[model samples]
Target: MEESEILRRGLDAFAELGYAATTMRELARRLEVSHNFINDRYGSKEKFWRAVVDFALLDVQSELDHRMAVGRDDGERLRNVIVQLYRLSAKASAMNRLMSDESTRDSSRLDYLHQRFIKPFWDSIEPTISSLIAAGRIPDAPTHIWYFAVTGPALALAQDPIADRLNPAASPMAEQDRNGMADALSSLVLQGLLPLSRGDATDRNG
Candidate 1:
């Protein structure tokens, strides 16, 4: 099988079956390849996970591009961005499950995710973040906090029954939802947090 196809199958299997439960043998079986073939192709489970990270990042980059292309207004742009992020969270719940479920089993793997996937994801999203800063909507909001507020809902989607209680999952958000979420988050940065330090805020308010 093609290398990408093999990796894709491995991701699906890992997500569905859990990382430990999904062995190279099972992955090979799912991909209709011999166990030895799987080993030869990916070397080890860790290597396969590294490939999944690349696959996931590629998906994220494409989603960000699509959202960026779809709108002009800040609210509209932000809404589309939220939708993209939410979808990614839902699709990758398995990875989150692994993090929570197997954290003790292999702490290093989770650390790898924080280093490779999470940090880089934040870096990649920085430009859009800088856009909000430039617009003065979030002049005082730290970039990392802005990152959390914008992406938190997406992460919430992966919740099991326990987490659902803390943050319920609604439908994929209608226009009103988008507007409400965007307005609330924007206000948290603009009106709730430290007021804009720039002279523009004074002029506008005065």
Candidate 2:
């Protein structure tokens, strides 16, 4: 079997039994091969897990690229970007859950996540935000704040649909709540930035 196939089967095992609970033998069984086959391909379970994480992040990157290509103004772009990013959160949350469970008290997985997934995501998107700022689509849009506003609810939205329904009073954000959430975040960004554009400022100060 291909190395990619081996990683795919390993990820399936991780999803089924969780990272900590999943073993190479379980993955080999899923692949219809001996554990030695998996070991020979990936060298160890950690390496296999790392491959799975990389694959999932590539999925996220592909989705993000598509969203960026859809062409929208700043507000609509933010909404679309957030929607796309949040959509991937389901798979990401599963990976995140596995990482946390597998590396309990060891936090190395968290570091791995930042390196393997989060940083690449940030690097890809940050320049887009810069372009938006240069085009007067957003003003003073700090990357951290923008990122937090757009992506903060990813884990909760992916992991807890019922919690969103049960507590609309406090946390009214479900996985399907993308439209409203997008509107709210878009409004916040546009209202903050549009007023600071050159034309708007000239009108105000002239």
Candidate 3:
């Protein structure tokens, strides 16, 4: 099989089993190859894990870069990025689960993900954020807080199984529901980031 196909299957396995639980032998078995073949192709389990993450994030990074480049203004760029992020979170539940698993602890794998995927993605959006702040389109808040505000809801919904049972209308698992949730989330984040109105500013000052 092609290397890309191998990496794709590896991503699915890693996403489902996480880094610690996923064995190279099992992965090879799933791929219909010998364990030695996998090791020979990727060198080690760590390398294979890294490859999985890289493969999963490759399209996301590309899409983000394209949207950010094509956006006409700070507001538009930010909106586009937020919408894209929400869409990805809703669609890639398994990948999100894997990321969540990694985030609960400190490890070389986590660090590698940060350096290879997360940091670069954040760096691509930082310029648009800076522009938005300078233009007073978004509040002058710490980047980390902004990140949480933008991503927190989608991640929560993706990880929470009971969410749909509790509120089927708001669940993003269905295509229609996912689009609606994406719209709502984008609006929520955008409205929160927008500059305070004159009355609100005056009241704050008073």
Candidate 4:
């Protein structure tokens, strides 16, 4: 089988079983190949895991870069970025699951994923966010808080089994539902970030 096909199966296995539970034999079984074939090609499970992450993240970074490039203004850019994230969460649910699971512990794999995928995406968007803040388009809030507010819901939605169990009515499963939720979340985020009126601002400052 092609390496890309192998990596795709590996991604699903890792996402479902996580790193510790996944094995090369299991992956080979999923791929309908001999275990020796997998080991011969990738050499080790760790290398296979790295290859999977690399494959998934390359697509993510490309899509995000394309979406961010299409906006005409900072506000539009921010909205575009948020929409892109929601779309990615829906499409690449496995990637979301894998990252979230890994993030709870401190590991070299987590660091590698952060430096390669997460950091670059954040660095790319930071300028647009800063520009909006500088222009007083958005209220001054900590960067991390803003990120959470924008990303948290969509990420939650990606884990739909948990989300559905928690609240089936609000869980986004269909494309239309996902788009509607993304729109509502984007509006809420933008509204929260809008500059407060002078009286309110002054009152808070005082």
Model 2 poorest 10 in a row by lDDT? 96-105
Q: Taking the tens digit of each residue's C-alpha lDDT, what string does model 2 give over 3-66?
A: 6676666666785577667876777778888868757877788877788888766667767767
- lDDT, candidate 4, equals 0.77
lDDT of 3 by residue, 1-206 (tens): 88888888887788778887888788978898987976788789998888878877877888878877777667667777877887787777667777777877799988997898778888988888888778776778898887677667667645546766777875544544666666777767667676446864675599
Cα-based TM-score, every candidate: 0.56, 0.58, 0.79, 0.80
- Candidate with more favorable, higher TM-score: 1 or 2: 2
Q: Rate the local accuracy (lDDT) of all candidates.
A: 0.62, 0.63, 0.76, 0.77
lDDT per residue (tens digit) for residues 10-63 in model 1: 776876787778887887789898878755876788777777766655666567
Among the numbered candidates, top lDDT falls to 4
TM-score for candidate 1, residues paired by index:
0.56
Task: Extract clashing residue pairs from model 4.
Answer: none
Question: Which residue pairs come into collision in candidate 1?
Answer: none
Give the count of colliding residue pairs in each prediction. 0, 0, 0, 0
True-structure RMSD, every candidate: 7.2, 6.8, 5.5, 5.9
